[model samples]
Target chain A: MIRSVFFVSDGTGITAETLGHTLLTQFEQVSFQQMSLPFVNTDDKVEWAVQRINRAAESDGVKPLVFSTLIDSQLRTHLVKCNGVVFDFFETFTGAMEKELGVTAQRVAGRSHGMGNVRAYSERIDALHYAIQNDDGATTRDYPMADVVVMGVSRAGKTPTCMYLALTYGVRAANYPLADDDFERGSLPAVLEPYRHKLFGLTVDPERLHQIRKERRRDSRYASMEQCLMEVRAVERLFKRERIPFFNITQRSIEEISAQLMQQAGLTRRI
Target chain B: MIRSVFFVSDGTGITAETLGHTLLTQFEQVSFQQMSLPFVNTDDKVEWAVQRINRAAESDGVKPLVFSTLIDSQLRTHLVKCNGVVFDFFETFTGAMEKELGVTAQRVAGRSHGMGNVRAYSERIDALHYAIQNDDGATTRDYPMADVVVMGVSRAGKTPTCMYLALTYGVRAANYPLADDDFERGSLPAVLEPYRHKLFGLTVDPERLHQIRKERRRDSRYASMEQCLMEVRAVERLFKRERIPFFNITQRSIEEISAQLMQQAGLTRRI
Candidate 1:
């Protein structure tokens, strides 16, 4: 049966989406049509949102599940009557927190993920620029300033890892593509010598790497299984020889890759 | 006084971080030192994590705050004994969710942000590749396939918006930079004409755009306040004239920008 789920929030709705998705994943049997309704702050907006949720409930003959983080009581009251199973995330926990800590919440929207701190925003933007500027070994001029440099064979999950680290943690991450030249020489690139300490390697299963490469450029030497195996083998050998920490991304997600990399590298998130 | 906050989880700890930070932000009176400890599944790891929390509590002279998403009973028991005020996330809501949904949780870690579905993982990776290939007015080769195309002047937050849409929602988002050449002509670029329906504009405050540009290229005419104002005004006029939805990114986070764009574009996340 198809079910409807709404992540309703007065701000970005990211927290509602993240938590709601996590909770929904537990019920693997149910197929959910999920949508996010962000910036639902006003009475008029909440009334409109309620009608939308109620319509979904009527059409499905089941109450749509709403996971909400709206802090305003008036807006929340409107949601409670939306003919849906409302999960009041902020109200549920914030009450307990106030009682436990003996301090009331400020009850403001967007404080969690807003532009509250200009410095933090700039740090993230700076990290984003760093990730783009140094992408795929484009430049090594600022290697010394990089928090970490990820090296991997093409399409082996390097670029996204760097981007995730930069965007999520405000970490200055750069990634380099471990090309055929490096594999042929059986050594690290000369440019990476000075910043060897900042190096983190990524290796993927040869079969998976082949699958990924085939998507980008079909029926080429780059997408061949033999080439994938050779590059992965060379990278692993170099990682072992240099004692640089590395990971295999064949079965891991970007979050897992970045978390493990940060742990292994002892790089605390700048944010 | 400095207080330490720990985001402890069985998975990547992102959920804990997001929720915990939201709670902490309410208490603006205190300064927090935040750290994430992900993949805390084993009893040994939990024990070690407890020690770290205790050390932080000892050093800070104020009980540390532990925001945990550990689903395992054994881990939760260990965490309760730690020298901190524990906020158990899963325990707080999972029982209620179980009763409401009539399904017991599987208690799986990393399901929220993991490689649970191979198809979803491949989709995300594929979209990411598409975004990188079609970034910054790079090409019109695959414009027909893009879920959305973000257009704006340089440093108007086009690249990250495309990347976020791609990475988070598995939307094949391409970005085109609306350069001085496109503006002086007083119309849309020739490449973007066919994909006008997929276009979303990002406009930043001229001052912020100037600051951002100055960082990229200091002391250049491109970074001047006059140049920034001229470009922003022209882009805004174009957005209005063409009836393309647009946003000002001066005070919004990337999360905010992406969520609003998804809403405006009516783009359902592919994942």
Candidate 2:
């Protein structure tokens, strides 16, 4: 049977969604129709949200599963009154924490995503600007400042990986696309010599790389299977020869790639 | 007391980190030293991770808080054996889901981030490409195809917001920077007139805008507080005149900003 899952929150619903998705992934046999109901802070909004949940439960012939991060007691009480198996995140842990720490929670909404620390926000923005400025090996003006320099063939998932690293970890990630000459020479690029120790590489299966390239440039020589195979082999060979750590991202997500990079490279997150 | 908090996982540790942080945020009065330990999948790794956690417990003179998502039962057992208050994510909900759904979980690491759905990956990549190509109003070749077009003054958080929307939600978000001329004209740009329905505006406090621009270009007219106030007031007036919904992202995180944009614009996530 298809289950209806609701991620309800007083703010962005990110915490609810993340925790709910993690829980749902364990139920491999059950399919879920997930919906995010963010910013349900007021009495009227909470009441409206409850009606939606009840409707879902009635239509699906089963109680909907609700994962909530509602910090307000009144709003959370309203949500629990709905016809669903409610997993109240704040409610689950706040009481225990209050007892342990001998203090009460602030019970504020959007505290996690609001202006908790201005310095942290500025640092993240600076890292993002660094990633943008150094994307695709466009500039090496401040290569020494980068936390990690990602190297990969075109369409081997360098740019998005760099962006993800920067945005999520406050990592100053610079990415360089390996060109034909670097592959032909079977060596690292001259410009990357200074930052060799900070390099991380990504390689993909030839078929996947070929498909990705084909989508970017339809039916071109660069998108051909032969070119993809050659590029992948050369890049892997270069990584091995240079003793640079690399990963095949053909079956991995950006989260996996970034986590592996941080662990393998001993990169510290700035924020 | 400053407690030690560990987010341990067999895969990327993202879920552990996200949920642990969310829970910890409620305890505002307590101090925490947080660390993420990912890819602890094997017996040896689990042993090493547990030892590390034990060390932290000893150093802190109290039990560490361990939030884990290890799928393997053996590794989880080992982790719980450590000197910490371990909250096992998978163990907590897996049995309940299995009982409810009448099936065993797949018990796999990195499934959430693996290449499970190729179409989703492709859509995300395409959205990223669109965000890059349309960033800062460089090109509006396919504005009609955009899910949302973000507009703001330079350094008002357009590029990073669009990128977050694209990466996180697979939304084809395009951003345009409002030039001085546009503010002077007191109207939307001629090129953006046809796509007004897709427009979403972002603004920032004059002080915040001044600080951001000062970082980008120090000791310039653009970074002056007077100039920042003038620009912000003009842009806000134009938005009000046009009845365009806008947000002041001076204190909002990218997560909150993206969620607000999606809700306000009624944009559908492509993925």
Candidate 3:
């Protein structure tokens, strides 16, 4: 059965959507038509959101499921009156937390993903710039500042992984792309030798690498199956020889790869 | 007093962390030392996590808040025995959802942020690559494929915003850095004229722009306050003159900026 799911929030609604998605994924038999109502901070927007939820319920012939992070009690009151089964995230946990902590919640909105902490937010931006500056072996001078230096062959998913790490975790991740020169040398790049302790490798299946490369540069030797196989074997051997921790990115999403990298490398998130 | 909090999950723990952070933000009076225990899919890991939680509880002389997204019921049974207040996210709502939908959940882990949907994962990667390739006016040819083209002065926070949109929402965002040529011409670049509807401007405070530019290139004309002021004024004027929607990004985080952009531009998230 298909159900309409709404992630309602006073702020970006990201937390609601993320948590709702996690919960919804368990029901494999059901399909969900999801919508987000972000920036519903005021009474008018909340009223509009209520109407929208009720409309969805009427159209679907079932009470829509609402996963909410709305902080205002008045807004929550308005939301619950709608014809949907509302799971108010803050309301569900805040009362218990208040009793446990012997204090009342501020109940303000936009604190989670807003610019509440200037230093933390700026650190994320700085990490992103650092990643871009040091991306794909752009420079070796900044390796000392990097929390992790990801090494992989071209199109092995180093750049996106580094970007994700920086943007999400405030991690200073620099990536080095292994090319023909490194393959010919048959050793870790000389510049990366000093940062060996911080190096992590990503290896993709040869077939997948070939497919990715072909999409970028077709009919070239770099995209050929023979080249891809040789590169993958060489890189994997190098990772083993050097005892650097590595993982296969053949079938992993960026989030999975980043989480594994942070855990395996023991890198703490700056944010 | 400080309290310890744990976001424990069988998978990446990201959802747990995100939702936990949102909830914790409401209790401004309490200080939390938060930790994430991901990949606790096995009994041994769950036991270890329980011990860790118990340790924190003992050390703090208070029950820690444990926000858990663990899927295994047996592991959850083990966790509830720990010396912490466990908020089992899946357990809290899944029963009601099952009853409402008249179906049993698959109780799977790693589906939310996994490569279970290859096409969705590839689309995210493709969007990331698109953002990079089309960044800083790298090429104007791909404007047709761009969901939104962000225009801003150098260091006006375009690149990171576009990157965030692509990574978080799978939106194909391209950024164009407004440099001497565009300012000199006093108009939108001729190439961008046809795609005016897709354009969004970002303006930053001159003082903030000076600070940002000075960090990258110290004591240069581009980093001077006068230059910053002039460029910001010109950009703002251009945005008004052309009626291009713009927002001040002086103090907004990437999440806030991207959310605002998506809402203002009427763009739907592909993810």
Candidate 4:
């Protein structure tokens, strides 16, 4: 039987996986199960979660370990009634934060630990970049289901994120490149017409583009600052003309980009 | 330019990338040139790290985001000399532990974090299983790198992991079925012999195996508890005799296994 049950905040199952994973490495003898309860702040949901935690603890030969981060008292009491060891962040941080912050967490942040959500956003962005690098643009005809298709000059992080959506969140992501000819012609590729509902453009600062391009080629025509700026301007106009949502990669990290894209595309975690 | 430097640690650079990518998501105006120094805990590498960090902070007009688990001092001091923000766990934990545990971390643990050569162990076990699952055993030639290979018996959590790794890691992780015949044969498939290094395996509890397989194939030879127990016994013996160091997948969550396999394969943050 597994020895521990780890409950994390809503949408942070992956973060719990990463942290719980490290903790599990230290204690090799025990098994762990992840219980992801999103939006546990509400009174009704917290009560339901408490019942589940109690059942998991009492159902077996030995009471299991409950390692949790439940912020609500409704959930905390249910946890207290359970017949096992309960290691909770709420227990650890509640009194401390109450003393230090001068106001309770409820008065400040709603069931905090959005840090995990931020981490998941990073994982999705990593996947997006991975997807972009792997997109063989020649054959990317008619793959559906990306809430948004991120188009940018080469080396802009796009495909990794699409794959992140597919790999981490089961979102189908397809990427198209803005080739030199397409840039010169000032247009997206022909095949992107049908999926225009999900098209977005990414452009970076010309100087950074120059540096990134310099890594692959030394002073090539495409890597030239003038050429990069020209392309960036063209791409921006295309995004404006085509009315596709677009963002500058210069001032934003992938997480910021992914969140904005998710918001623009009306996407959220399935959980 | 930013004022802080950040360091994230993984047993290897994988954890570094995971967190580094996440931490960068916070600000839109922030731009930090991300650098990852792999295998930096050794003594000689410290000065070189310090030089680079200082150079970045001063010359690049950007605070360095150094994602490292530099357990060794010579390397960390390199950054210590620089005037930037340095946030690192290896520094945090080891420094805390040195004061709290009353012993130097180097004395407490030989190294800070690693799946402690688990990649090597996983690969060794996985190699034989990969050999067993090959359908093209009839062919007579040098084995091509496996298009797909997986290790783990039924209900062993190998299938989902294999699929995830294949789909996400872009690794074709083909899992082998470990029935009595495969075990009794006393050797992996001939096709796998050529690609032995590419084999991988997963192991789990017999009762769990029965419960999982029961749902899919009831009243069959494969689903029988007795059969599951016998096959597990035989395959384990075979693994022992073959000198394959295996992991007990029964207790491990999928992310841990996938992370371990990716680390074992040296495929962290490749894109």
lDDT of each: 0.87, 0.87, 0.90, 0.53
Q: What tens digits encode model 1's per-residue C-alpha lDDT throughout A153-198? A: 8888888898889889999999999887887788788989999889
lDDT of 3 by residue, B1-271 (tens): 8999999998888999998998888888788999999889999999999999999999999999999998889999998999999988889888988888889989988888888677777778899989988988889999999999999999888999999998889899999888777778988889999899999999999999999889889999999999999999999998999999999988787888899889999999987
The segments of candidate 1 whose C-alpha lies over 4 angstroms from its true place after superposition are none
Reference-based TM-score, model 2: 0.96
Question: How high is the DockQ of candidate 3?
Answer: 0.82
Q: What tens digits encode model 2's per-residue C-alpha lDDT throughout B4-40?
A: 9999998898889987887788787899999999988
Higher-scoring candidate on lDDT, 2 or 3: 3
| Comparison by TM-score, 3 against 4, better one | 3
In order of TM-score, best first, we have 3, 1, 2, 4
| Candidate 4 residue runs with Cα over 4 Å from true position | A1-90, A93-142, A218-227, B1-253, B259-271
Per-residue lDDT tens digits for candidate 4, residues B92-187, read 434432342233444221122332443442342233233323322323242465544554565565545654554333454555655556776887
Model 3 compared with the native: what TM-score? 0.97
Provide TM-scores for the models: 0.97, 0.96, 0.97, 0.40
Q: How well is each residue in A90-177 modelled by candidate 2, as lDDT tens digits? A: 8876676666567888887877666567777777878888988899989987899999999999988898888888888899999989
**Which residue ranges in model 2 land beyond 4 Å of their true spot?**
A98-103, B98-104
Question: For model 1, how does the per-residue alpha-carbon lDDT over B1-271 read when each residue is reduced to its tens digit?
Answer: 7778899998889889988988888878767888889999999999999999999999988788889988888889999999998888888878887776677888877787778789988888788878888988788899999999998999988888888888899999999888788788888877788999999999999999999889889999999999999999999999999899998988888888998899888888898
Worst 10 residues of 4 chain A by lDDT: A107-116
